[model samples]
Each structure stands twice: as C-alpha cells, then as structure tokens.
Target chain A: MNIAVVGLGIIGGSFCKAIKKYTDHRVIGINRTKSTAEKALKEGAIDEIGTHESLENADLIILSMYPQAVVDYVSRYGEYIKKGAVVTDVSGIKRAICPQMTELSEKFGFVFAGSHPMAGKETNGFDVSDADLYKNASYIIVPCNAGDSVVNMLSDFAKSIGFGTVKITTPEEHDRMIAFTSQLPHVLACSYVLSPCCPNHKGFSAGSYRDVSRVANINSTLWSELFLENKDPLISELDILIENITKIKDAIKAEDTDALKALLEKGREVKQALGE
Target chain B: MNIAVVGLGIIGGSFCKAIKKYTDHRVIGINRTKSTAEKALKEGAIDEIGTHESLENADLIILSMYPQAVVDYVSRYGEYIKKGAVVTDVSGIKRAICPQMTELSEKFGFVFAGSHPMAGKETNGFDVSDADLYKNASYIIVPCNAGDSVVNMLSDFAKSIGFGTVKITTPEEHDRMIAFTSQLPHVLACSYVLSPCCPNHKGFSAGSYRDVSRVANINSTLWSELFLENKDPLISELDILIENITKIKDAIKAEDTDALKALLEKGREVKQALGE
Candidate 1:
C-alpha cells in the first residue's frame, strides 16, 4: 500500500515513522516546509517527497495539520486524489472538519474518515516525532460518510502501527468528549499556572503541581484555533469546571469539613471507578 | 543514632525503609495498628517496635501521622521523649503544626522542626511504601524556632533519605506556597472529575486528561483535614484560580481569539520559565 502523509509535523512525521517501522507500506511525505520532508526522507521515515500528482497513487492519505488546514488541503487537492482512496485526518476537533470532508469525498469519489490519535508530547514538530507515539494510545474514528469497510481498514492499520484500541463514534460525540477530556484540561492547566503564586512554586511543589501544570506548556496558536472552532462545547465544559471549582472553594471558605470531605470523596469514587 | 518513627502508614513506612536502605540508624516503628509495626519489623524496615519507654532513648523522633495526630501525639508523649533529641513531622500543612510543635518542644526540651516530604503516590498504606520514594523529590523544612544546628541535622537526614533538595522557610510561607502548589491542584483535580462527562472519558481522553485528573484519586479524609487546617491560604489560591479560569472562559465565549491566544501564551511563558 502507498500511504501519503501530508504536513510533516509531529503527528505526520510520527505516523510516517510508525508505518515505516511496522509495515511494508510505502510512505510519501508532504510538507509546507520542504526541509521537514527532506529530514524525514533522510531519516528513512518516508519513501519519497510527495507532490500533488502523487495523490493519484496513494492508497491512504493522512492529513496531519491544524483543523482548518486539513479542510483546506482536501478542498485544494480534491481533484487530484484518486477515486476509492481513503482520506483521513488527525485533527483534535472534528465537528467542523468531518462534515465538510464527507461532502468533499462524495464529490471527489474518495473515502473520508475523520480520525484523531489520542496521544501527543509537549513538544511539537518533526524533530520530536517518535515511531512509538501511537503505542497503546486510543485511535478515534469518526466515520463521516465512510462505509464499514473503510472504518475497519483504518482500525486495522492503526492496530498494526501499535494503537491499543479503536473507538468508533460520530463527529458530534467526538467534539463533545474532546471538549471535556482534552480542551478543558488544557484550559485548566493554563489558568492554574496564571495564578500569582506560580512563579514561587519551586521548592514547595510536588506531583500535584507537576500534573496540573504539565499541559500549560502548550502550542498557543494551534490551541487558540481549536478553542474557537469548538467554541460552544469547550465553553460549556469550562463553565462546568469553573462552577465545580467554586463549590469546593465555598466549602473550604465556610470551613465546612463535611461538605469538603464529601466533595473530595465523590472525586475519589469517580476516579476509582475508572480503574485506570 | 536511635530513630523513632511514630506511624506505619505510607509516609512512615517509607521513611523506615529509606533509613534502613541508606543509613545505619536504628529505626523503631510505632503505629496504632500493632500488625503494621510487626510487619515493618518482619520486613526488616525497622529494628524494633517502639514504646513510650523507647522514646526516652531515641536521638530522632519522626511523627509521620496526620496533622492533628502529630500534635496530639507530641502532647501525649512529650514527657517521654529524650532531651536534645531532634523531632520532626511529615505533615502536608505546616502553619497549624509548626507553632504548636515549637511550644511543645520548649515544654519537653526536645528539638522540634516541621518538615514535609514533597512526594507521594495515589495509593497509600505500608504495603505500597518504597525505599526510594523520596528520590529526587523536594523536602521542605519549616524552622519553627529550631536553631540552625537542628535545621541542619533535619536537612542532612532528608538528603540521606534520597531527597534532591532541601527548602527552608517559615511556617507561614510554607503554608502559603503549599496552598497553591499542592492543595489547590487537589481541589482542581477533584472538581474536574466531578463533571458529568468523566465516566464517558475512557477513549476520549489522553495525557492532558490523565495529568489533570491524576490527583483526583485522593485520600479524601486526609486531604479534607489538610484543606480545612490551611483554609485561608487554600481558599485564597482557589479564588485566584477561579478568577483566572473565568477570564479565559469569557474570552472563548466572546469568540475573542486574540485575547484567548494571549492568555494561553502567558501560561506557556510561565511553564517555559520553570524549565522543568
């Protein structure tokens, strides 16, 4: 199989490396910056540097760019993509991208499935990409209009490249869950670190501080775009988080030990139930 | 030196194991549960089970129980502790324990210094305690009228137990910093998992979710006591966090991308400055 990976950033470069390391698939790397594609080629992460003409030969096309960039890339290169080819994306949010990609796939006679690999590092770019980035991570497949065969193909491919699980859901469900699990945590981390006390946390901190503030070192430009694109869901999650925090704060302020204990116990129960 | 560790929970048990692994001190284990002390002795983590009579021969006494328990124990056994012995605690909160321990030291003639080991796992109990639990973790010392020599002795002891750094500060400063670094993160994590969406986060979550919610699996009873004991400082930190989250929420709700970007950028800057 010939796999064309567009945008040689962290996600794309990692996908290229994983495919090269795990399977016989020929990977063609494409990037806005030719240097990143050249670097991946030099490292043997990809078989060749891809041009728009290469889309006609690709069995699978993975778009690994920002949310809007994924949509825009498909629109600009739709005509060049071969019929029956599978096209997927590694976007964090899907509501805005899935529907449009489905429409474009129908028009172009290709298969469009929105995928999000639930894994990442704090750093970005091809420099830090790893073949094991997707190892034991969940791979979410939002079958926009793609059939069962397309979904299964993507799932099998993900598993071959070390994904532990493949979850099938709709784009709406994906956005809603991502809002709580991903975007909201980022917001909390960012806000948690903005406190006046953050600068002085050197000697006094431990695991709790490290965990809460770990995601605060973020890609601000990319995240701001994602936050605005999924505005309603992200905002809703943020409001709930803020309200929940206020309840705990109020309990502490009133010195209501019972109330505070109950709240903490509830959280512990929820976490224990997850059995992670 | 003769060392008496008056508790056999996670912290106390770990201290015993660390001392046995890294030093030649004779460790005496004490616990409300006699079985736990026997187990520590059987495991060779401690040399003997401690009694009130044993306290008189000890050169160092470590109170590794809850904040109030530490106070109550010192008050109950102050007369038995040997003169010139260095006494310390491993409680999370300091403001409430430090001054009380200092006065008890004056009355009993044993040197008292409040200490907090800045490392822990989500699980507890002696069974899970490890000798290297303090490896590369911070050890905070609140010098509650203990002179430089006593402070130095405690600092050296912590380093011998694998602590990477020893931080010395006043009880008030320790409490203020801990409110933000440790207590507030627990509050945030607890409140975060309380969301209606947590149970459904199995496949939808990744590192951000795991990091932010990790501490939610807390010892509720222990944390509630710590939170209430350091109520003012924790509440102040919580309020600031709430306000900061609100500002970000307002920007996202208003679709003010520039404002959202700037807020995220500030968080990134702070995290980068920490260089962790």
Candidate 2:
C-alpha cells in the first residue's frame, strides 16, 4: 500500500515510521510546515516528504492534523485524494470530525473513516515520535458509509501497524467511550496537579501522588482544544465519575466501612475484569 | 543502632533489607511464626531472628506490623523494650497510632515517633522484598514530644534507607495529607477498576488507565484495615476529592467548558508544581 500521512507531528510521524518498520508499504508524509516534513523524512519516518499535491495517487490517505484542521483540510482537499482510496485520521474526538469526513468522502468519490489511536505521551511533536508508539495500543475505528471495502482496508492498515482496532458503532459512541476512558481522567489529573498542597509542599509526594499527576504536565493548548471539542460526552463521563466518588465520600463521612469496602471492592472487580 | 523489626511481612521484610543495604546497624527479625522469622534471617533480612526478648537490648525498635496489630502487640510487649530506645513504625496511617505510640513510649522507657516510607508493591510477604524499594521515594516522618534525639535517630534511619524525610507537624496533619495523597486516590483507582466497563477491556487499556489502576489490584484485606484505622482523615479527604470530581462532573453535565477548563487547569497546576 502507498500511504500518505498529512500532519507530520507526533502521531503522524510515528505512523510513518511504524509503516516503514512493520510493513512493505511505502509512506509519503505531507506536513503544512516544510521543516517538520523534512525532519520526519530525514529521521526515516517516511520514505518521502512531499507537498499536498503528492497526495493524488496514494492508496491510503491519513489526515493526522488537529481536529479542526482535519475538518477543514478534509473538506477542502478531499478531491485531491484518489478515487476509492481509503482515508482515515488520528483525531482525538471522533464526533466532531466524522460528519465532515463522511461528507468529504461522498463529495470526492473517496472513502473516509475516522480512527483514534489510544496512545500518546505527555510531551509530543515529531521529535519524540517513535515507531513503537502503538505496539499494543487500541485504535477506535469509526466508519460511516465509507463502505465495507474501505473499512477492511483501514483495519488491515491499522493491524499491520500493531493496533488492536475496535469497530465502533458510531462516531457518537466513539466520542462518548473516549470521554469516559481518556478525557475525564486527564481533566481529573490536571485538577489534582493544580491543587494547593501539591507543588508547594514538594516534600510530601508519594508514588500514588506522582502516578496520579503524571499526565498533569501536558500540552495545555492542545488539551484545551480537545476538552472544548469533546465537551458534551466528556462532561457526561465526568458527572458519572463524580457521582461514584460522591457515593464513596458520603459513605466515608458516615464512617460506613462496609459501604466504603463495597465501593472499593467493586472498583477492584471492574479493574480486574478489564484485566487492567 | 541495633534495630528490631517485630514483623516479617512485606513492609517489614523490605525494611530489614533496605536498612541492611544502606546502614551498619544490626537488624533483628521477630515474628509470631518461627519459620517466617527463620526465612527472613536466612534471606539476610535480619542479622538475627529472635523473640520479643530481643527488644530488651535494642537501641531502636521498628514496629513493622499490621495497623491493628501495632496497638495490640505494643501494648503487651511495651514492658520488654529498652530504656531510651527510639521506637518508630512503617504503618500506612499515623494519627490513629501516634498518640497510643506516645503513651506506650512513656511507660516503656522509650521514645515513639512515627514514619511512613512511601514505597511498596502489590505483592506481599518476604519473597518479593527488595532493598531498593525506598530509593527516590518520600518518607514522611511524624515525630512526637516536640522532637528530640529520638526524632533525629528516626530521621537518620529513614535517610539511611535512601529516603528524603520530611518532618510532619502533627499526627493529624500527617494523616490528612496521606488521606488525600494516598488513600483517596487508591479508592478512586479501586472504584475505576471495579466499574463494569473496565472488566475484560485490557486491549483498550492505555498507559493512563494502567497508571490509575496499577495499585488497584492490591491486597484488599490489608487495605481494609488501613482504611478502617484512618477512617477520620480518610473520610475528610474523600469529601474533598468527591467535591472536586463532582464539581467537574456538574460542569460537564451543564456543558460548561469554562468550569471544565478551570478544573483541568487546577489538576495540571497541582501536578506540575510537584515537579513531576
């Protein structure tokens, strides 16, 4: 397969390198910034670094840009992609971009599906990108009218790069699931980090404290955008998490050890079931 | 100092190894079960394995028993401990035990201060003990009676085991701090793990999920005792955590991006301030 990756940042650069390492597919990278594209190619992330014009004949096209850029770019350049070629993305929130992607695919006679690889680092960008980033990670695949052939191709492409793809029911489901799994937790971590007693009382941090706050030091601008984009579902999940914690707090307040134990036991069971 | 660790469980065994590795002290292992005591000795966790009689000659006595066991064993054996010997502990909670420890010390001709080395693993017992457990971990030192030679000796012992010790103002302060930093987080993790969606979802589990749930698969029996013992402060911290989480949840439900952003920012600032 000939793969064209737009946006040569952390996810895109890593995808390019992974394709080169794990498959016979030839990867071409297209970044809005020429320097980043050049760096990706020079770092062996891709077989070639090219301008957007080079996207014309690719077997697969991936929009690895920010959620907003992906929506804008796919809408504008959907026609440049080859007819019947598989097109997907690495956006965080699927619902926000999936509709635009579907419309773009339909208008351009191409196949568009949205994908979210559940992997990243606190520090990002091309410099920290590696081929092994998705070695054991999940990639949520949301296909809407992209056709069965295109979905299969995208799934094959994702599997070839070492991802366990979950065929999500809809973009809404994908977004909501991720809201619970990723977004809410990040929000919680960030809040815990900024709490008054933390950085100020440096001497008191333990392993749990460190682990809970590991993702606190994040790219605030990017995260802020994501939180805004996926606001609806993320909020719902946050509410559920808060409700669960509130139940625990009330039980603790009553000194109800039995209730607290039951709550903790439930969590343990859930985590064990998830095999986490 | 000649130190006697009066329990050969996970923490005690690891303590013995860490002290031996970093200090010149003579380490003694005491356990109700003779075979376990012998095992700790044979494993080099102790220079000697003996009875409560060993406490008579020791310059320092490290109480490495369970939370409830500490009060019980100390109350009965308080008569055997040596004059002017410094007594300390490695229990998870401080407030519940420190007052009793102070009272016991007064009657036994010894000084009782408390400490908690913030390092451990999910697995228990002597078999999994390692001397490097405390390296790079914070050790919270709670000294009693306005601090004295005993406090200095306890601090030295904590430092000897590769920990940076911080002096806690009082037992209540120590308990409240740990409840937030340690206990509440554990409850959250345990709850997340027990949630239905998490069970059998390992393939979708990322570093974030793993980070949060790593400590969930803990020894629940031991945790139950700790929770019950430190019920007061644990309950207080649980309320704060619940409130924080619930506040975020409400913002999410109302689709309030500003509120969500503020909460996320709070966590991020707290974590980053810790220099993680």
Candidate 3:
C-alpha cells in the first residue's frame, strides 16, 4: 500500500516514520515546506517527496495538518484523490472535521476515516518525529464510513505505529472525551501557569506544581488553532471544570472545612473510580 | 547539640535520619504513637525516644506535626522548652501557625523560627521516610527573632540535612507564596478530578490527563486542614485562577477564535517566562 502523509509536522512526520519502519507501505511525503520534505526524505521517513499528483495514486492519505488546513486541503484536492482511496487525519478535534471530510470523500468517491492520535510533544516538526511517539497512547477513530478494509487498515497502521488502543466512536464522542481528558488539561495547565502566585514559584515549586503546569509550556499557535476549532465541546468541558473548582473555592472562602473535605473526598472518589 | 523532632511522620523522620547521617546532633524523637517513636528509634532516625522532659534539655526542637497539632503541642509544652532554645516546624501553612508560635516563643523566652521544607511525597509516615528526601528541595524559614544565631543555626541545619536552599521570609509572605505554588494546586487538582466528564476516562486519558490529575489522588483529610488553615490566601489565589480560566472560557463561548488563541498565547508566555 502506498500511504501519503500530508503536512510533515510532528504527527504527520511520525506517521511516515512508523509506516516506513514497521511495514512495506510506500510512504510518500507531502509538506508545504520543501525543506521539511527534504529533511523527511533525508531521514528516510518517506520513500518519495510527493506533489499534488501523488494524491491520484495514494492507496491511503493521512492528513496531519491542523483542522482548518485539513478542511482547506480536502476542498482543494478531493477531486484529485484516487477513487476508493482512504483518507484519514490526526487532528485533535473530530466533530467539525470528520463530517466535512466524509462528505468530501463521498463526492470524490473515496473513503475518509477520522483519527485522533493521543500522542505528541511540546516540540514540533519532522526533525523531532519518532516512530515510537505513539507508544502506550490511545488512538481514537471517528466512524466516517470508510468501510471495514479502510478502518482495519488504519487500525493496523495505528497499532503498528505504537498506539496501545484503537477504539471506534462517533466524531462527537471523540471531541467530548478529548475535551475532558486532553483539551481540558491543556486549558487548565495554561491557566495554572498564569496564576498570580506563579511569580513566586522560584523557591517554592515541587512535584504537584510541576505536574499541573508541565503542559502549560505548549505550542501556543498550534493549540490556539486546535482550541478554536473544537469550541463547543471544549467549552462544555471547561464549564464543568469551572463549576467543580468553584464549589471547592467557595468552601475554602467560607472556611467550611467540612464542605472542603467533602468536595475533595468526592474528587478523590471520582479519580479513584477511573479505570475501574 | 541536642535536637528533638516532634512527630515521627515522613517529614520529621526524614529530618532525624538526615541529621543523624550528616551532623553530630543527638537526635531525639517525640511522637503521639509510641509504636512510631519505637520504629524511628529502631530505624536509627533518632538516637532516643523523647518525652516532655526532653524539651527541657534540647538545644533545638523541630515540630513536624500537622498545623493544629503543632499549635496544641506548643501551647502545652512551651513552658518545658529550655529558655534561649530555638524551635522550628515543618507545617505547610504558616500565617495561622507562625504568628501563634512566635508569640508563644516570646512568652516562653524560646526562639521560634517557622520552617517549611518544600518537599514531600504523596505517601506519608515514617516507614517510607528517606534521608535524601530534602537533598534537592527548597526550605523556607519564617524568622521570629531567634537572632542571627538562630537563623544561622536553622539555615546550617537545613543545608546539613541536604536541603538545596534555605531562604528567610515573613510568615505572611510564606503563606502567600505557598497559596499559589502549593495550596491552589491541591484545590485545583482535587476539583479537576471531580469534573462531570471524569467518569468517561477509562480508555481516553493520556499524558496531560495524568499530569494535571496526579495530585487528585490526594491526602484529602490532611489537605482539607491545610486548605482551611490558609483559607484567605488560598481563596484569593483560586479567584485569580478562576478569572483567568473564565477569560479563556468566555472566548470559547463567544466562538471568538482569535481571543481564545490570544488567551492561550498569554498562558504560554507566562509558562515560558518562568526561569528565564
């Protein structure tokens, strides 16, 4: 199978590297930056640097661009993709992206399966990409009716690339789960670093402070794009968290130790209940 | 020098072990539970099991009990502590305990310099204590006129016990700094783990989820006491964080991608500005 990975950034680059390492797939690269493509080729992440013409022969195309770029890419190149070719993505949000890609695939006589690889780093680009980046991480598949062959192909691809689990759900479910599990943490970490008390962190910070704010050091521009694209579900997740936080905050404000303990106990119970 | 460590919990146990390992102080341990004290003695964390009479001859006394227990113990035992002896504690909050301790020390003619070791694990008690726990961590001292001698004494003690740094600050300042770095994070983690979406985390959680929620598996009973004892500063810190998160939440609600991106960028900047 010939797999073309678009955008040669961390996610796309990783896909190419893993496919090249684990399978006999003909990995082709399509990056906007010629330099990035050259780097991927030099690193042997891809067999060839692909042009728009390469979309016509790709058995599978993986879109690793940010969500907006993805919409734009499909709009521009959907007509050129080979009939019955499978298209997929590594975007964080899925509700907004999956349906549009699925529709475009139908009009263009191809398959579109939306994927959210629950793996990445603060660093970006092809140079830092690793075949094992997705190791022990979850890979979510949003059903876009790309057929069993395509779903199985992508599942195998994900597992071969080190995804610990690949589960299927609706695009909305993907966004919802990610909002609480992934997006919400990023938002919380970013906000946590901006806390007024952070200026005094020099001699004070320890494990919890470091742990809570570690993700605050993020790719701002990329995250900004991701946050805005998944607005609704992300908003709901934030509101739920804010409400929970406010409850505990109120207990502290009122010096209600009993209430505070109860709130924390509830929180403990919730975290404990996870994975059980 | 004779050193008495009250409470054979993790912190005090570690202190005793380190002092025994690195200094010539004759370490004595005071504990509410005789078994814990016996365990400390058997583990060689302390040279002797201490009684109320031990304070009469000790050159220094270190309280490692919880905040309320420290207050109660000091009030009960202040008269027994030898005049001119310096005392310190390893309590998490200071404003409530430090002032009371300072006043008690003044009344008793003993010096009280509040101390907080910025180190601990999620687990507690003497059985898990290690001499190296403070080797790379900060120690804050709230000086209460033990004079230069007492400050030097405590500073040397902290360093001798493998603390990375020891700095002096007012009790108010210590509480304020900790509100942001320590207390606020506990509150947020406890609260964050309580989000309505947490029940769905079985196969969805990843790195960020684990990072931010790590402290959600907490010592809630102890933390509730800490949170309420330093309620004012903690509440103020919580408010600041809520306001910041709300700004981002509002941007999401408005579907204002630019504003959301800008908020995230600001958060990224704050995190980046740390240590640079």
Candidate 4:
C-alpha cells in the first residue's frame, strides 16, 4: 500500500516508521514545513517525501495533526484523494472528528475510519518519534461503516504497529472514554500540581509526587485546544469525578469515620480489580 | 546507641536492616509475633530478637507500628522506657499523635520525636523489607521542641539510614503536607481507577494507565484508617484541588483555550521546579 502521512510530527513520523517496520506500506511524508518533511525522510520515517499534490494517487491517507488542522486539511485537500482510498486519523477525540471526516470521505468517494492510538509523550515533534511508540498500547477504531472493507484494513494497520488491543466502538463511545480516561486525569493532575499544599512541601516529594504530576507537565497550548474542542465530554467526566469527591467531603464533615473508610476501601477495591 | 524497633513490619524491619548495614547501632527487633521477629533476625535485619518486655533499657526506641497501635503501645508500656531514652515514631500522620506523645514523654521522662520516611512498597510486612529502601528518599522530622537534643539524635538517625534529605517541619505542617501531597493523590488515583471507562478499557491500557493508577491498588484497610484519622487536612486539600479543577472545567465550558493552556503550563512549571 502507498500511504500518504500528513503533518509529519510525532504521531505521523512514528506511524511512518512503524508501518515500514511491520508492513510493506511505502510511506510518503507530507508536512506544512518542508524542513520537517525533509527531516522525516532523512530519519527514514518515510520511503519518500512528497507535496500535498501526492494525495491524488495514495492508497491510504493518515491525518496526524491536531483536531482543528484536521478540519482544515480535509476541507481543502480531501477532495483530491483517490476514489475508494481509505482515510483515517490518529486524533484523541472521535465523535466530533468522525462525522466531518465521514462527510469529506463521502464527498470525495473514499472510506473514513477514525482511530485513536493510546500512545503519546509529553514531548512532541518528529525528533522524538519512534517506531515502537505504540507498543502494548490501546487502539480504538471507529469505522464510519461497520461493513466497509477498510475497517479490517484499519484494524490490521493498528495491529501491525504494536497495539495490543483493538476496540471497535461508535464515535460517541470513543469520545466519552477518552474524556474519562485521558482528559479528566490530565486535568486532575494539573490541578493537583497547582494546589497550595503542593507548593508547601516541594522539598519533601518522592516518586509519588513526580508520578502524579508528570502528565500535568504537558504542552499547554495543545492540551488547551484539546480541552476546548472536547469540552462537552470533558465537562461531563469532571462532574462525575467531582460528585464522587463530594461524597468523600460529606463523609468527612459528618465525622462518619466508618463511612469514610467504606468510601476509600471501595475506591481501592475498584482500582485493584481493574488489574484483574 | 542501642536501637529498639517495636513492630517488625516493613518499616521496622527496614529500619533494623538499614541500621545494621550503615551504622554500628545495635538493633533489637520486637514483634507481637515471635516468628516475625525471628525472621527479621535470621534475615540479618537485627542484631537480636526480643519481646515487648525487652524494650526496657534501649537508648533509642523506634515505634514502627500502625497509627492506632502506636498510642496503645505508648499508654501500655510508656513507663517501661529507660530514663533519658529518645523515642521516635515512623507514623504517616503527626498531629493526631503529637500532643499525646508529648504528654506521655513528659510523664515517662523520655524525649519523643516523630519521623516519617518517604519510602515504601505496595506490599507490606518484613517479607518485602530491604535495607536500601530509604536510599535517596526524604525523611521528615517533626519535633515539638526545635532545639531539643532528641531532634538532633533523630536527624542523625535518619541520615544513618541512607536518607538523602532530612527535612524539619512541625507536626501540623507534616500532617497537612502528607494530606495534600500523599493522601490526596492516592485518593484521586483510586477514584480514577473506579471510573467506568477504566474498567471498560482495562484490557486496552498502555503504560500511562498503569503508571497513573499503580498506587490505587493500595491496602484499603490501612489507607481507610489513615484517611479517617487525617480527615480535616485531607478534606482541606481536596477543596483546594477541587477549586483548581473547577477552574479548568469553566475554561473548557467557555472555550477559553488560552486560560486553560496557561493553567496547564503553570502546573508543568511548578511540578518540574520541585525537588530540583
């Protein structure tokens, strides 16, 4: 397969390297910055570097930019994609992106399968990309159509890149899960780092403090856009977490030690059972 | 100095083993169960094994029992402590035990200082104890009287056990810091594990998921008791965390991407600045 990878940064660069390692796919790197595309080719992330004009002949197109850029890219260049070419993405949120991607694919006569590889680093760019970036990670596949031949292709692509589990879900399900598992945890970690108590004992921390706040040290600009774009589901997840936390507060206020113990015990049990 | 360690659990066993490894302090291990103390001795954790009755003439006594049992041990055997013996505890919380310990020390004619080593494993007991567990970890000293001779002794002891930093703070400061930095993080991690998305995607988790939730699989009974004992400080820390989190939520709702980004950026900065 001839693969055209747009936005040759961390995700795109890593995808190209991984595809070459696992399959016979020949990757053509495309980036807004000519220097980045040249770097990707020099790093062997892609078999060749190409302009946006190469979109017309590719068998598969992978969008690896941020969410808003994705919208712009599809709107402008998506119409030039080859008919029946499978289009996919590596965006974190699926619900908002899937519909628009599906719309563009229909208009351009291609197949759209939305994906989210649960692999990322605090650092960004092609310089940090690696072929094994997605090893043992989760890959959520949100096919626009269940019966599309491209669904299997997308699944195989995900497996080839070292994803341990490939889950098939709706766009809404993907969004909700991402909000709960990723967005809320990052928000909580950042907030915990900003708390006054954290500042008070900065000198006394160990691995626990570092581990809890590692993700909080992410690129703020990218995360802010992600939080804004996925606001609805993020808000929903935050509400639920806050509500559960309030129960802890109320139990404390009532001086119900037993109730408090029960709450913490339940939390511990639930967390432990996840490992099962 | 002769060192007597009461309660041959992970903390006490590790203390004995570390003392034996790094110092000439003759460690006498005491446990409610004879087998545990024998195991500690056979494993070379201590110079000798003893019953509670043998705590009589030790120059330094380290109380390494559960928080609840510490007070009981003090009340039951406070008089058995030799005159001018410096007593210290390895308890997590300090405020709850400080006043009573002071009074008990005054009546018994011994100096009581509190110490908390910021190192532990997920598993408990002497079976998992190691001499080097405290290497490079923080050791917090909570002394009621700043200039007391026992404070110097405890500081030297903490250093002798391979602790990199010996931080001096009041009992109240210690309790509040533990609540914010340690207790609150544990609570959040356990709650994140309990979320529906976590359980649903248990099979699809990456290293990030395991890294964030590793502490969630803690011992519930002990943690619940700890939380219940430090309810006030934990709740206060939780409120502060909640306020910051709610700010993130409002930013998401308003689509104030810049504000959200700034918060995350600050969090990253603060987290990175710690322990530097």
Q: Which candidate number maximizes TM-score? A: 1
DockQ of each: 0.88, 0.50, 0.62, 0.55
lDDT of 2 by residue, A175-274 (tens): 6666666776677676565444554445665677767777877766567678778877776666666677777767766767788777777776665554
Best by DockQ: 1
Candidate 4 local lDDT, B179-231, one digit each (tens)? 87688877776666766677776534554565567677677677777787898
TM-score of 4: 0.90
Q: Kindly give the stretch of ten consecutive residues in candidate 3 chain A with the minimal lDDT sum.
A: A267-276
Q: Write the per-residue lDDT of candidate 3 for residues A105-152, one digit (tens) a residue.
A: 888998889988888776677878898888878888886877787788
- After TM-score superposition, what is the CA distance of residue A252 in candidate 4 from its true location, in Å? 1.6
Ranking by TM-score: 1, 3, 2, 4
TM-score of each: 0.99, 0.90, 0.91, 0.90
- Candidates in order: C-alpha RMSD to true structure: 0.9, 2.8, 2.7, 2.8
The digit string of per-residue lDDT tens for model 1 on A226-251 reads 99989999888888888888888888
Model 4: pairs clashing at backbone N, Cα or C within 3 Å? none
True contacts kept of 2: 0.52
Q: Where does candidate 1 clash, by residue pair?
A: none
Worst 10 residues of 2 chain B by lDDT: B195-204
Candidate 2 lDDT, B42-94, residue by residue in tens: 87889998788888978888788877788888899889899878788888887
Tell me the number of clashing residue pairs for each predicted model: 0, 28, 0, 0
| Model 3 residue B222 distance off true place after TM-score fit, in angstroms | 2.1
